[model samples]
Target chain A: MCFRDAAVRLRAQTIWSGVSLEVAPGEFVAVVGPNGAGKSTLIKAILGVHALSHGEASVLGLPPGQAGRRIGYLPQRRSFDASLRVRGVDIVRLGLDGNRWGTPLPVADRFRGSRRRDRERVAEVLELVGATSYATRPIGQTSGGEQQRLLIAQALVHDPELLLLDEPLDSLDLPNQAAIAAVISGICRDRGITVLIVAHDVNPILSYLDRVVYLARGRALSGPPSEVITSETLSQLYGTPIEVLHTSDGGLVVVGHPEAPAHHSDRHTGRTHERP
Target chain B: MIPSAGATGLSWNVADDVRQLFAQHFMVNALAAGTIVAILAGSVGWFMVLRRQSFAGHTLAVISFPGAAGATLLGVSATAGYFAASIAGALVIAAVPGTGRGRGYTNQSAVIGTAQAFALACGVLFVSLYGGFLDSLNGYLFGTFLGVSDRQVLTLLAVAVVVLATLALVGRMLLFATVDTDVAATRGVPTRLLSIVFLVLLGCAAAEVSQITGALLVFALLVMPAATAQQLTARPAVSLGLSVVLALVIVWLGLGVAYFSVYPVGFYVTTFGFAGYVLAASGRALITWAGTRRRATPAVTR
Candidate 1:
């Protein structure tokens, strides 16, 4: 995947501009940034749902949206209403043929042997996410972490060559965060599918990061975590005194970052606001 | 004619009532029409409730009032007018400038409300200008089930078939779009087009249902059955099928009861539909309450 000086604008405000980045095949990249830094806008551009004000983005040698079913996405976490009638396994099945035209006529499926094939695939993806126990349960009844796992199953049901996740760790507890991160990294290694995960904090995914694309103030800097996550890089990025601390437990933490803009934090929770 | 039961008022003879209900040709036509409307409304209203487009669907129902009234004044079939105006109303709603994201709800509602208000005014104007007979307006607004001709039933059947076939064709993709719009669009599901198409289908259902429950009470068939089924279950296929069954039951019961009473079919249908919804809602609440009590007792003992 490659973005050449891509820019996105909504209304009179320019969300971000002149951003460029590239990810090699089988790479796992994290997009970490403060609120209102246009991370979502960048994802929209790459998904080909939103037009860029300037420049271009391509996935697998084709324009963004043209990647079609080959690019799978796990959207931001929003609670499904309890009344939603779709089940956990059905959600995964949607990723398999949701974009295809025509009805998934049951009779046609029976004739073509696709129904059994689809059922097997859905089962495999559910097992991979460890959500098979409640696969028949309604999505609304599941916990946030369980729902996240199911959503990951949905994104992987199609076995896409490229997978993009928008805040796959939001609202999750620490253990869930670790589990989802592991699932994503495991998928990357097992399937050789390129992954780009956007998050407010990069710590949970630090262990698996092949590179980090940190965005601040309409600018993006991409490199290995050790190169871009230092005190010097983020301090310059946010125009404040920020410190990247290495803990004794083999985890990394960023300290002394400025308080986030009120609107920005309100819009996107789960950001790295810990002041330790 | 209601059969009297010795000293106990009305008899509860199911076999006789079933025979009497479809005794007349017009009654059979009404039964057939009701069946079609129930199935179409049940299917389409499921999507309407799921997408939270009930307000938009309600606006289209209101649009049918002026449509029928204008057709009456112009000496045309009210059914044709109902469909034409409601389809136009759907397009207008779809054309409203908003993607229904965070900031678009108020704008979309404003547009829908304005259209509804204007349509209501037009209906009043058209009714006032009609010189033939003012009582016909009541039938359009309140619905009349006693005099449905065979031709009208056929028309309803045709429209219902088209709507149901279209839904079957797009149901999967539409469900995906309704459940996870952003992800579906990102995966190339054409979410915009799907939404617009669903809106058009809602309009079609509204127009057909208005013929039985009237423009003012179209919700009797369009919303109640689907809402009740959704309240009762959380599986799409089961809920969808249950919605249709409930709708058919309501319509059948509504027509049967109206045959023996002085009230219109619309009133009975609306009453029965509302009753079903209330029953489902309270049933769910009761289950929750009982479960909570059970859990609380165990905690208290510990």
Candidate 2:
């Protein structure tokens, strides 16, 4: 996807301002920033959901909405009509296919398509995301972590060349985070699907990203992950010197404003709902 | 409930009467109205479930009651009164936030409760001026066909078709918007307009159900089939279709039971509809169990 000087404007405020960026084919990129940054907007703009008040953007050379059939997008969260109960596999089927009206159940006359036809494809994506065993579970019954993986699978089911994931790892534990990251990296490394993921902290996706774009205060900075993931650049972006921590578990890259009040991480341990 | 049939009709113990029943003027009118109302109820109720607005469905039913009663007192068209009150209530529901998962009925309940009380209070005032609503008032509260003319049935069918056609056209997108409305809007599914359209349809459905079964028995037309459809399937497309099918069956069955048992059709339909949901759930469990045994052993060909 190539986004040149793309800016998104909403009625109330400008989300992405004068944003110019490029994502090469098959590149694993992370559009990372703190809360309220234009990372989400920039992505939605590329997806053509939000109108670009400024520049041109394309996915695999086509406009975002036009390119939907070829691009897999995992939104922040996917909710369903409470009464429209569906199994996990069916959720992914919507993505695997051409992002059609919805995954309608088996009926006599309606033709079958790649979305569900990619049965083995569903299993492959499931295994990649470590949600293989939960395929039969109703999506509502799954835990947040499990649901996140199913969402990623739902994205991959279509087998799009470009995957845009917004906050895919939100509210996940470390193990689940690692699993999700591994699945994403595996897709980029093995399947040649370009990944553009959004995240709050850079530490989780640091190892997977070739490039990380930081957005703050309506401005953005982008470069190779190695050069861009730095305390000085982060401090300037946030306007406060931040600590760059290297966690004991061979993890590195965390930056936050020093003067700002430090908040506790709200991570908790919980299992995915075990459905009989 | 009130299971008394024609206390003065000669057809009391008539034998093997298909033509006698299906061809009767009153029977035809009842069947036509029930079928039309059932179709609209099933379709709109499908979205009501998707939007998780059963309470909205129920409250709108409550709010529209006094309209029909007021009309009865004023000797005007009950349908007109119900239509006005229902559309008003739909607008009120729209102003309430989080129509989705409206199990958060507390705030909406307060608003609806106030609306219901005010509407009924005004209706009581109207009734007093007229000095006796009598059987007509009972008809609006519980529902009796004593007041339904054939023209009313035709009018119900006309409104029913319009609502169904609009819903059918926007069927998929509406379902998409109903589930994760933000995503659907992001995908350019016209979220805001769809919400208004859906509420308007609800208003229309409420009016029809309110006029026929009275607002109290609107659930016979609105909630049951859709709720049963929810228990049966989770797919929007499937559940939508199932709701309609279930509604058709329930309406026919309820009408049948009402005829034999001599009761308000709404009472029989509502009770029977709840029974259907219970049956569907248990049937679903049984189907799952039987299917699992066939695939009990996972096979790895690779």
Report the number of the highest-lDDT candidate.
1
lDDT of 2 by residue, A78-149 (tens): 443223476777666544432244324456214555433566787888888889897776677677678888
Backbone clashes in each candidate structure, one number apiece? 0, 6
Model 2, chain B: what is the TM-score?
0.84
Highest TM-score scorer: 1
How high is the lDDT of residue B256 in model 1? 77
lDDT tens per residue, model 1, A1-276: 998898888887888877888899999999988877878777778887678888888889998778877888887666676656668887888889887766544456566777789879999999998999997877876787888899999999998998989998877889889999999999999999999999887889998999999988888889999999999999998888899889987677777766543443466454222111
Q: What would the TM-scores of all predictions be?
A: 0.90, 0.79
DockQ of every model listed?
0.55, 0.28
Candidate 2's iRMSD? 4.0
